[model samples]
Target: MIAGDPAATGRPGLLGSVWPFWVLFSAIYLMLRWPFVATGRFIDPDDELRLVQMRDLLAGQSWFDLHQYRIDPPGGVVMHWSRLVDAPLAAVQLLLRPLLGPALAEQIATVIVPLGTFAVILFLLSRLAARLVDRDLAGYCAVIAGVSFPLASQVLPTRIDHHGWQIAAALAALLGLVDRAPRRGGALAGLSIAVGMAISLELLPIAALFGAVLLLQALRGAEGRERIGAFLLAVWAGSVTAFALTRGTDLTNYCDAVSPVYLAAMTIVCAAGSSTAVFPRLTMPAYLLILAASGGLALAAIAAINPQCLAGPFSSLDPLLGTLWYDRVAEGRPLFTMNGVLVTQWLVPPLMGLGAALVLWRRASGADRALWLDYALVLAGTVLLGVVVTRSMALAAAFAAVPVAWLVRDAAQNLPKRRGIGQWAMSLAVPVLAIMPALPAQFALTGVEALSAAPAKATAGAQPRAGNAPLQAQDLAAIGNLPRATIFATFDIGPTLLRTTHHSVVATGHHRGAVPMRDVMVAFIADPAAARHIVVRHKARYVILAPDLPEISNYREFAPRGLAVRLADGEIPDWLVPVPSATTARVKTFAVRY
Candidate 1:
């Protein structure tokens, strides 16, 4: 580093150390995310709902009541989300609302909260990258984190969902894995997983993988035993506290979220694991016996608390819903099942990262080799997990960032010594492809297709997407003027409808609303009379069809004579009276004439 480099010394204060990352990340992210910030648009339905969740919390909804009362009316669906996620968002909104007024405050909250999360992720990754390679590459790590689509997408502006938090927790776990202090590292890994699990049980698999890695280390010696023991104790302690504070008096053991059942299971693991550290350094065989018995004991406790959970959350999902809705969620599906181009884009960064990990492991020696080997195994396992569950790829991408950065640095530093132009080009291409695997390929393919389709494009007139913007905007304005009432709508429209107006929706794409979602899906695919009966059953006063009505195309196809198709064709049933149009609002709103 140069003598006067502020970032290199990190001398000013806490923020000074990470200010370079913050400024770099913000500059890159804001330019890229300017469109969403300008329009106050949310990237995902989940983010819209997260805003609703934050609003409710700030509006004085009980902390323990995780119900979206607007979702199913009288008997609302109980959300599996924890209050921990809602806290920071509410705080931000509360802080800004008085100054900017309610509307502007909300828009700012969405942007600020996620951008804050983005900065944290970069700082953590840069520190990890610095340890793995060089402190000089910390800025490079920040740049890559902001520019990398997989990592950036999770925490970009208006992305208030918990996915970013989960990624941060996973990085914390990775740091814990490599930390020198056995107890602190284990505690960091354990508590971070606990927090992640409290937010979403998606972390369950990560917790298991981490637990296994820690357990394997325990077999080596006493330092290893302390690490494993601290992990179990910390997880057990952390999960218990989170459950009590968040769940309150709600005692019904839920399979979908962390409940007493999980805490009980943790108790068994903690007690057994802690014993290994208390006693004299035991034989590997002794540790094996204890671990085996602990698993059995935990399973037995789970059976006592809620045996049904053993089958997992999706076990009880209605078969029809699974076929129509759950099966079609692209992000939730395996990598191979996704579009080839999309799969390649997501696979490249992490695969390159794993390759780097293998290189780092091979080149290292002594304890460093063992550390890199551990990193390699975890990275490889996470990559495999991402292959099976595609959204997990984001976490894998974040994990891969350090090694990928290190690899890029190694290549760049060796560039001056290279003999050929071909070598120079290859070295240059490594970082480009590493950061954006799909863009070049996508651009090339798009260019080829554009040339081939030029005549068709010239004849077809225009695309609907640009046209959709104003129609959706005007519909939101119109709906916002109406009286608050429950509206029966398609799955994708539910979240935004709730956000933009003082309206309630029967259901959204959220799985916790499974029962109501089932009824809604059935109505969409049923005969007009049947659909009317279902709509009236929910006590909904209106039905909204999004501009494209693209969300329920499955309903239109599965039942050709279904309500979704009838509505799309302007074949309104007698029971539905057309709401007055402010403009040619393609997202049709129908008032139920019950």
Candidate 2:
């Protein structure tokens, strides 16, 4: 038996025994994450954008209003985000500001809030691991989670995007699903799913999977019925509560954010769940009939209310916007299409975890079978999601830690008992390889380096200087120093410009900001006369270009004879006057000559 197995050793409750371990793991995580926090190196544009939103909130933007006024002027873009995330960030900053001063307070809040969120995720993962395996194995799982590259990347200090919170909410729901108690567990799961959906529709896939699991469990027996019924009630109530707390007063818009469509669907689901619980004696075939009827009715109701949403939120997006902006986001790409380094970074750990899960499933018996099945479901769902979009890799890595921990613990116990150098090597290698991507990453790096070495060497000198490159704070700061005016910039660079500079940007990476994003794209790829008209129409005072940006390549490809291509080829347009910069020459600025 495993060392901490409750069946064999009569251990206490999982939560009661795991508090100290959580503290230790949290401390270790803080230490691990401190460097990134201290250096203030936010990896994603989303993180910077989050800071921008938080700063705006602190500057006294209405709690219900999530518009970024700087982006589209007086009207602004309605950011499809909940104010729930901003509350904690603002509270922390306000609390710390008097003691640390404004800048320091903001920095501390940036580092601490995400780390705190990460700790909660670690605790939840540990709890799930303990239930799936044993207490000792759970500690190992926490360690694996602590070191998970994809998970860490999102939760690192200075990274304050909704993704980390969404992952936490998903894990919370997963934990609730595995909870033994019927009503309480179901409610918890329902509430978590509701909170996740309230945050963003990104959680829809996993949320739907969890709902299916609950419904299936309900169909199985009496206890399942009670759980599912409670879940449905909580989902309906929780979604309504979440929407009330987070959404703006504009209740009519069903296209983005939680609206009447979701409320109606949840209401129907609640009715179906309640019927199952109230009539537990119903036959399987009868129950199936009732469920199908209720679900179909719910779909029909939602379709009647908002047929546009039946196709999904982005259904109304222009084809050009999809082609030029949405499709190009790196996170949305498939794992197979990604470079070897990314593929290894994402797939290896999850694959290891999947292998371990399969091993455990074969050996599991009695009550443990149910627990392992839950783990398998989460692992499978997240792995499938990761295959579709690399962003889901973080979630897959997080869920994978449990089984990976089991593999490591099993190897440590059985292999080391043997008496030879080979035994030592195998045992040491197994745990190390299971925990870290270092070994597989080396193999991936070697091939990738070989394939791209010549190109890298050729472009090394032509590449922008370190300080002036897009995403560099210093470069954006230099742009900010110029008179505060609406700047027309590439889609990729817009977020950083908005976050770092005082000037309003014509476009950013957000899909909701598609109007200006489309305008900017057209301006870049259109004729000089057409581009000038767009710039003037948007009242944009400055045009900024970060040479060799990926968007520029797209622009050149789409319109070979356009102004952007001419600029790229060193042919300056007569109507645009180049502005000299003392800071860095890599970023070129042009003022429209009216």
Candidate 3:
């Protein structure tokens, strides 16, 4: 019998061992990611920008100077990212620099750090699963997590973005929630949430859910009160430390990024938790009343101080930005609207996992039942988030692996002992089903043909043509060799320009660079005369266009008679002198004549 089986006796089965499976998974991940590492193809704009940040750090930029001066010139755009992610990356690069030199050391460090994060995530998932089910089942869950497409993609080579770290923080919080030891668990969960918030506000929904769970627990009794109090203290401490260490003297910016406002809010919440812990003997009704009062006062104080934040960080976003840029971001779209393959890959495992979790919850009792309920809540919340935004699918899939592993293990164990072909096929089917959804959709579609046919319909960026290769470093190197000047380029190619060349960019995909992004959008979509005026006013020396980029479609649709449209149609204006490059140049560059 499998280790988790209720009827099993004696020693655990094959899947019970954790380290063997972890080693195997790590090997597989490295093998799969090695190709991308060799190519140095940083998949997303965020990853490329991370390398730029690291380079800046190594080049003697101040630790608190998060500004990319190359992007907006004299007064650079202040990045919304925290320096927490940079520490380890820069450390690894520094450690290896003596042996591998600068370039090679950076490449190896970039590959290793993300994969190392993947390993940590797997261990956390295993530990979380072990609490919910048996050790064997936990191992299976680790395997499922290892294979999860969305989760794995985020930590793949050169994907040094903060998304993977956010997911790790989320899982760490989950582990804390399920721990039997109240104080330690509460502290862990609180610290994880605080770290996640410090990284990015993307985890705000999950963080809220965690906060709600703690509140509910506290309402139950004194033990809950203790846990909640511990949680609050940890959050307060972690947030303050993270802020002080990362933001340094620039602590007043309370807009998009985490700032003094968040610190104040956390302090208020911590005070409430401390008060509850102090009066643990209070009646249920009185406790509830105190909680309500504390929450009301906190919200009131926050609103009074930063009324603009009540509208959310993106409240100040221009309508044109909402319509043109954010609306086009694939991850922000709902699950149903995403590509069929992604929908299949993302939705299936979670749905099955949820089903498995429900089954287990129904059978459980006492402490087990409570644990299962907590796990179920997390899974359910993530699934709901996935439905709302496609990006949350990764988190959903990671959590889903817990229960789905149980389902796979249980099914495999129940198979007949006979060595017939049917039995073998049935045994194999359990894991296969757990890994992928019904294969009818996956098998029916042709490889690149189907993806290409529905390029615009696909999530994220437009799909490249079947035979076409992506733009490489060499392609951007030529443009980088030109005179040091701000290059006006699409958001997708901006980071590449920054990485491959010494030139600065007008705008990237980051929302914090909204003003420059808006200017770029307006110039691209406006008439030639207006475009020239904006370009000259910004002192943009060169304009670079990657005509085949997915964002180009937005430019064409939004402004039919705009400069970008005319340029794409081979009507280069006299004022914009075309800079000659190799015939094979994937990007076209033009000198912006005043």
Tell me the tens digit of each residue's lDDT in model 1 across 1-594: 111122332433434445777776777777887887787676678888888887888888998988998898977878888888888888887888889988888888877888888877877776675555556666667666766777788888888899999999888888788765789889988888888898899989999999888877776677778988888888899888888889998988888888888888889989999888888567788888998899999999988878889999888899988988898887788999976678778899889989988888888775567667777778888889999998999888888887887778778888898888999999888887787788877888888887777564454566555332322567688877778899998887788888878889999998888889999999988898999999999999988876465565777668878898888778889999988762244677888997
Give model 3's TM-score versus the native structure.
0.91
| The 10-residue segment with the lowest total lDDT in model 3 | 1-10
Every candidate's CA RMSD: 3.1, 3.3, 4.5
Task: Record all residue pairs in model 2 with backbone atoms less than 3 Å apart, i.e. clashing.
Answer: none
Residues 29-148 of candidate 2: C-alpha lDDT, one tens digit per residue = 667767656655566778778888989988888888888888877678878887777777889999999999978888888877887787778778766776566666656776777667
lDDT of 3 by residue, 346-376 (tens): 8888988888888887898866676676777
List lDDT for all candidates, in order: 0.81, 0.77, 0.79
TM-score of predicted model 2?
A: 0.91
What is the C-alpha local distance difference test score of candidate 3?
Answer: 0.79
TM-score of each: 0.94, 0.91, 0.91
Better of 2 and 3 by lDDT: 3
Better of 1 and 2 by TM-score: 1
Where is model 1 more than 4 Å wrong at Cα?
1-18, 454-471, 582-584
Give the candidates in order of TM-score, highest first.
Answer: 1, 3, 2
Stretches of model 3 off by over 4 angstroms after superposition: 1-16, 417-429, 447-469
